[model samples]
Target chain A: MTRVRVDLNISLDGFATTADQTPDNPFGQDWGRLTTAYVGTRTFRERVLHDTSGAGTTGVDDEYAQRYFEAVGAEIMGAGMFGLHEHGDDPEWKGWWEDEPPFRVPVFILTHTPRPSIEMKGGTVFHFVEASPEEALARAVAVADGGDVRIGGGPSTVREFLRAGLVDDLHVAITPILLGQGIRLWDDLRGLEAGYDVTTEAAPSGITHITFRRESRG
Target chain B: MTRVRVDLNISLDGFATTADQTPDNPFGQDWGRLTTAYVGTRTFRERVLHDTSGAGTTGVDDEYAQRYFEAVGAEIMGAGMFGLHEHGDDPEWKGWWEDEPPFRVPVFILTHTPRPSIEMKGGTVFHFVEASPEEALARAVAVADGGDVRIGGGPSTVREFLRAGLVDDLHVAITPILLGQGIRLWDDLRGLEAGYDVTTEAAPSGITHITFRRESRG
Candidate 1:
């Protein structure tokens, strides 16, 4: 079964992105503070940063971090998340992730200006497409080959997928901080827990991870 | 030392109160759902509901629920919380808590129309005063007599106290539910975590308890 999944780091006040971003510092200080728990995870170090050394936390947070990467055959993200809005018309710019991007699958970037697919190292291919969430999901699912489709986000993109009820599994790592400014994740998602079996676990690093898995509709 | 404390049940989307309130059902159904974890606790069962059967959850939720009713000499709350606005000038309305009120201390009601103090059976005296958050805190602190003053909330009252930097301890039980409508708890309190030492714990009942204690400014 190909499940649609989402994982994000949000503040206790429900902000997923930081407002303290600048031209120089694209992801502000609050972003670091919010994602501290995820970044400190062993799986995050190994997967995202490609840190080969067996360092970093291998606790509950790492367990969730490990789960985030597993079973995700394809990813869909917004143009802003791909830094296309920032690096406009720069054909050489291939996103913040260097040669070895973490996602080792076909990543569909939702944008009007669909660029040629750039195949990075480690089996990661960046495919730009001008498609709605449903269309993107279909593309992702077609290529997923029975693996799960992950709605890899920068908040807004994830929210659209959530609003459409396309998500089957959702996880949010809530850092114990309040960034009063940023893109909020739960703006119009009232009564979102009706169809999902929700669960919460606190990490020692002060991150409360809440998971919502959609039960089979009987 | 007389510390200023606050405890509230908020949704993951930051709503402290529910929107599904009618004249007949003042609290509404969402209120019951939001407080299910708290009301199911042993301490809440004994203290608030006065259940002597010793039947309820005695887990992390109970521990916090037990602490909520402790070390409080006085409570400061809003007029709405006291149901003053709902039952205007009706002498019989002693509050939602029928006869045996929860707080066994002087409860200061922040209102424009100061009425005669109502003394309930269980040492719970309701004093109405038209004062600001600081002024109410001063009155509460004076009567507290070396005991901590708890800002018993309706959300707005607690936010006022928090904005004034008068709160020493703030604990919020983030119920894993998205309430699309109602009063938001976190607003304009940007960089609110600067002085507080934050911690989080997840309860078995799917509640994420986040505690923020004011660290020494020095």
Candidate 2:
């Protein structure tokens, strides 16, 4: 069975995005610290951003990031992350990653409406699915063959999977940023049962990398 | 006038609580880091939990946490933070704060139905209000006098404030834990206009502390 993983950054006060998420500020104050910590090092940045020259080095955070990427064979994302085109009336919107995206595998996007598949350079293929998380995961698993499926999130899609109990191993890069009010990953769940054990932890470049494996409950 | 500040911690992948929230694992893997970094420090534990000290003096995270508490005169939270309890035939629920919550100020809970105020020792009063976020803030500000009003969250309340654009400063301590499935701080606002500037960045105890100040579009 393919292990499902959903990952993202969170603040101490508990907010994912800042109040107003305009393009000028992608991640408010947290992105820089998170990026530097996760991608700042020579080797890590070069690897993820697809650069020839590696600038970052071997640290705990870098190691965790590397582990996360290495474990991912396929990815599932919410439309919120695919692009900000959801807000505008135009249908010509693509994503923030002009032409080529970061993921180098088959990526499935969860949306209410369906669209044709978008093929980017590299092996990145964007497929829009209007089905629920489980349905998408099922299709993704078929496409994944014998690899782990990573959930690229905008929060809601991840929550759907979590609510449905579909994720396996998870890693979250904790970035120090507070949005005072944009979209928060934790909203209406006060009475739910969830448990996890820390599999790994690292602190580097002012970012903390922690991994958790969901505990199966009878 | 005391400005209102929202403070929190988040994962890089963006989850506030685990997919299923329970007391045993109130916040999934993030809670452990928070306990050790925010509440487990010798100085902080003695002060916030045992009342044997004032506050932690050193470390970036300690300093940031101290500053956040100092800035708040009162806290306004949501029902999600209160956890589950059987109130009436409708499953009446109270908060999970137990007898004496760490907060030593007036705490207002935003809810649709009003309840009698429950006063705790050390000045923490749980007042259930059926007012809007603006109304709750008004009461909080008045109670705070000249102290900053802190919008303690569950997500809905935070979104209320964020949508209103009433928050001034945000202090976030990002934790390195991923629930993979849980409530997120930012699930809505698919097409909202928001912006901010990171004024401070620091890493201590493996957690990053980042501050974002709301910016105007003009």
Best model number under DockQ: 1
Model 1 root-mean-square deviation: 1.8
Runs of candidate 1 with Cα error greater than 4 angstroms are A216-218, B215-218
Candidate 2 — which residues are off by over 4 angstroms? A19-30, A42-44, A84-93, A191-193, A199-202, A215-218, B1-218
**For candidate 1, lDDT tens digit of each residue in A1-218?**
89999999998888888888888987878888988889998999999888899999999999999999999899999998899988958998899999999999999999999879999999999999999899999999999988899999989999999999899999999887888988999999999999899999888888888999986332
Residue-wise C-alpha lDDT for candidate 2, range B1-218, written one tens digit per residue:
67778877655344555454466875555455444567645446654567565544456666666776685788898866665223422433445555777777888987666677888877788888878888888899888867888887765667678667777776656554444455555555332223655543545455555665765322
Residue A71 local lDDT, model 2: 53
Alpha-carbon shift of residue B131 in model 1 (angstroms): 1.4
The best candidate by lDDT is 1
iRMSD of all candidate structures: 0.8, 8.3
